[model samples]
Target chain A: MRLPPILVYVLRRLAIGLVVLFGISAVAFSMAYLLPSDPVTSRYPDITNEQRAEMRRQMGLDQPLVVQYARYMESVFRGEFGRSFGTGNSVVQDLAQRIPATLELASFGIAFGVLVGIPLGLVAAVRRGKPTDHLVRVVNIAIQSVPAFWLGVVLIFLLYFQWRLVPSPIGRLSPMFISPPPVTGFLTIDALLAGKPDIAFAALRQLMLPALVLGLGVVSPLARITRSAMGESLGEDYVTFGRALGLRPRQVVLGDAFRGALVPIVTTLGFVVANVLAGAAIVETVFAWPGIGRYAVTAITTSDMAPVSTCILLIASSVAVTNLIVDLSYALIDPRIRHEYAR
Target chain B: MGEKLFEIQNLSIDTRRGGVTRRIVENMNLAVERGQIYGLVGESGSGKSISMMASVGLAAPGLLVRSGEVGFGGRRLPASDQKGLRGNLSHGVSLLFQNAKGALSPFLTTGRQVERVLAQRKVPKPARPKEITELFRLVGLNFADLGEKYPHQISGGQAQRVAMACAMASNPALLIADEPTTALDVTTERELLRFLTRICRERDMAIVLIAHNLSLVSEYCSGLSIMHAGQVVEEGALRSIFATPLHPYTKGLIAAVPDVDEPHELVPLEGSVWGGRNDIVRCRFSHRCPHVRARCEAGLPPAIARGGHQVHCVLYEGEAA
Candidate 1:
């Protein structure tokens, strides 16, 4: 039986994605191996040379590089990422616990970016030469220029200390409330599932500052892409033709031009999400949010190869998946692309 | 001539760049009677498109409509009030562009595009599909075959027809076709123009066929205004203007068309439309006119009328006197 062309296209993309994921894992493993500090020495600095050699042998690090890589890949295929010296827990367990926090933060950040950025961009494109366009451009540039961590610190100072508007920049939940049982792993969702609105709201409130800091970083690129794309779409002959047909200005701008602009905006959104996932390390550390980004950072500093490589593979896979979704979505938004793929 | 359907009087447009304002279109006037196919012939950058677009309140954002009045559907609206003109006049007018495919929304199927116009014209939802099919058939397209396809899925000729279907959906009284056939081959161009003329006669619709090719205008238009730079160098009924070519620029334009029966050396127009200075209030064609004289620089010459033909040139000034 023949598969449909779209299904074939998706399968091909998935196969390529798998190969890329494998390549990324290999690279991450090699790069970790090349690190100057040995994981054994870094963890137990006072150990004798013989003890170090024995530990390396036990960990399979004494084997040839290819053999070690083969063994690592085998364990990875079995869903085993070994143990993280930094946390004294299995790498998979550590990631499972912390991935939720990162995902929660990143999702909120992306939501903030899309909600605020797309409208601002459309406004800028519509009022291209006016003061509003200029103001949006200026504000986007300002937000993009400030470092995410520094912005997080400043926001914490203002909203937490000076104004007392939000709770302390501690972890995901206040000390008064224990975290809900992990259902989907998102604290807010898990809390709500566990029938605790107050805990869910507290989780959300704790999410705001870090998410905003990460989101502010995301806004500029999304808005700038949206502005240019929408601007180009607005200038298309269809817009003038639509106006000439007596379509309402709102219909012409939002219905026609915005839809035309969505392809690029969505493509940019994928890139933004991938970037946020990877770049959330600084903000996560600042906010004391237990996400994979902070975990990766901690692993890197302590020369814990297992968690570091796992985090790299996780981030790389997310980016690959995002790109795949973006490519697939192009077919959904544009019939031209769909036709091309169908053929 | 039949009753006037649309008119543009004293329409001028300016563009400001780097703190300098330059007039791109000057004191243009046009009148199209019902069921007439009028031609606005000019080279690129001669403001043929700008003037018509400005009259309909569709001019580019940077272009300033300095002064004008557009008399359309029996209402004389100030050309500067673009918002008012657009809102009031759009239902009575529709535009067809050179690149029909580009002028179509790529995301919408061809039928949906036409249906959108029908909806905007307040055709009830249940009736839109039939109306769309009727329009598609009217434009020489099969709705079932082509309606479901997007712009890129069809050929150039089909896209143009789809655009035509969209234009006809509003039942516009005046169709401003801005180089509608520029992107098509010769056979398709003739077919489209013939279809346009047939539609005009059948519906009593007026069409302003804007083109750079004088031959195309000569073949189809009843009356025409010849634009050079920003000004109309000549305006007259087509037969009379072609018979007794008065303006030097118009004569040159006619001479430049290669006749297949009697081959002659093509006398191509000498300077481009952009060679003139915007600061001088003289005949804009003076820089390119073969018959340019010192008197040509005095200012824009007054229109010297003969029968229904008008020529703005110093050569005609003496003859009129």
Candidate 2:
């Protein structure tokens, strides 16, 4: 039996995504190899040539560039990211241990941005020239221009130091609390599974300020895109037709207009997700949170080639996968494209 | 003719931009009885579509009904009462626009689109499918072949028929068709107009047909309103308006229409539409009127009654019936 067209399309995308990821990893590996500060020199500034050669050989650096890259690819295939020069732990294992905290932050940040951005955008578009629209526009522009690190610091100062409204911004958990058992590699979900409401609440409270800052960073672009998309959709003939059919104003705005506006909004959301992840890396540093972002930052600062390459490779693959999902959603969001895909 | 089903009296519409308001459609009086096709004819920006839209409470954004009273089913409709108008829409008022393909959602199939209207009309769950099929059939579409196709998949004319089917889903009493055939070829235009007239007859439905082409209006309309520069120039029974072209603007419009039997040089109207901000109280078409007089600019000409017809021109003020 013939498989469905959508399945075939998704499979083709997956194959392309893999090849792109492979290309990205290759570029990342080469870039990391070319860095002036390698593990040997950074670890021992006054090291002799004999000691340097031995360290290089152990890390497979003495081999040819192609051989090193092939070995790196082989190790990556075996779910190993080599080892961090400082800690001597598998980079993959280090990332796996810390990913839950980052995932927890970025997910909440993006969800907050979208959940709040869409409604604010709809209001702005629906009342295009009104005071509310002007206010939302000004606020969004402010958010868009403000850097993530500055916003995170400001939020921490205002909410923590000045207002004393929030708990200290140290890491994912409070000093009094212990982390919940891991399940599905998401801290919040793991906490809920571990059935420790107090621990979960504490983790969430610790996440709030950094996530809000990161989320605020993305909200502006999402809201701007949504506003324009909805404004255009609202001007469409079908929206007027819906109104003429005597459907309620709510129905016309939300049902007909929103559905038409969704394609562009979905496309924006995919990019927003990727941007939030990148923003989280900076946010994680500001808050001193133990996530892959800080882990990668430490590796880069110490000239650890393997961990840095692995981090770049991971980020690029995740972004590529997000874009694939976005491309697939276009078919689902619009029947015209879906029909074209079938053809 | 059936009793009057709807009327718009002294309708005035305006557009507000940057704290400035300007009148676009002024003192528009129109009446359409059940089963009658009332043609509102004018050039673009004459506010023909705006007037009809305001009548049905679907004015485009930024255009406001400054003053008007819409009467439907023997109840007076205040211009400000939009919620009441929306409520009355299901008491059967529907609209069809010129761009039929654009009027249907591209995201939904044609059949599903029709079903959306039916669902809005509150048709019972079990009966909606049957009703959708029946409506598609009524509008001359085969549900099996064309129903599942998106608006872009079908031909323009077919898409229009789908729009017509969606309009019929509500079984409306007053159908406001705004240049419904402007996008179609000559043959499709005629077929669609004929289909519209047939529906008007079969359902005893009153239709406000807003169009620019004089020939199409003359062919299909029983009653006609000729508009110029946002004001009514002449109006009455179509035969009487055609016979006695009193307004100079009306005469120029008729003269511009190409007549195969009496072929002559097509006289395009001399001047473009009046759009400047001046002479708030004067006749708008005075600049374009062939028989313009000093009195024409002093004030707008009042409608002069003559044998079941009315013409807004100073020349016709004292003419004998």
Candidate 2 lDDT by residue in tens digits, A1-343: 9989888988998999899999999999898878887778889889899999998888778899999999889988998888887678888778888888888888888888988899989999999989999999999888888898988888889999999988998988887987777777666677889998888888888988888888887688778988999999999999988888777788889988998999999998898888887877799999998987988888889988888999898888889889988988889888888877787
At residue A301, candidate 1 shows an lDDT of 95
The Cα local distance difference test for each model comes to 0.89, 0.86
- Evaluated on CA atoms against the true complex, candidate 1 attains a DockQ of 0.70
Q: For residues A22-126, could you state the per-residue lDDT of candidate 1 as single tens digits?
A: 999999999999999989998999999999999999998899999999999999999899898888899988988898889889999999998899988989999
- Please report the candidate that would top DockQ against the real structure: 2
lDDT of 2 at B9: 87
In angstroms, the error of model 2 at A319 is 0.3
Expressed as tens digits, the lDDT of each residue in B1-321 for candidate 2 is 569888888888888778877888888888888878899999999989888777777777777777889899898988756667666676688889899999998888898888877888778889988888888888878999998899999998998899899888889998999999999999999898888888888888888889999998998888999987788989989999888788888888998999899898998889888887633668899877777888887756677898678888888777787
Poorest 10 consecutive residues by lDDT, candidate 2 chain B: B79-88
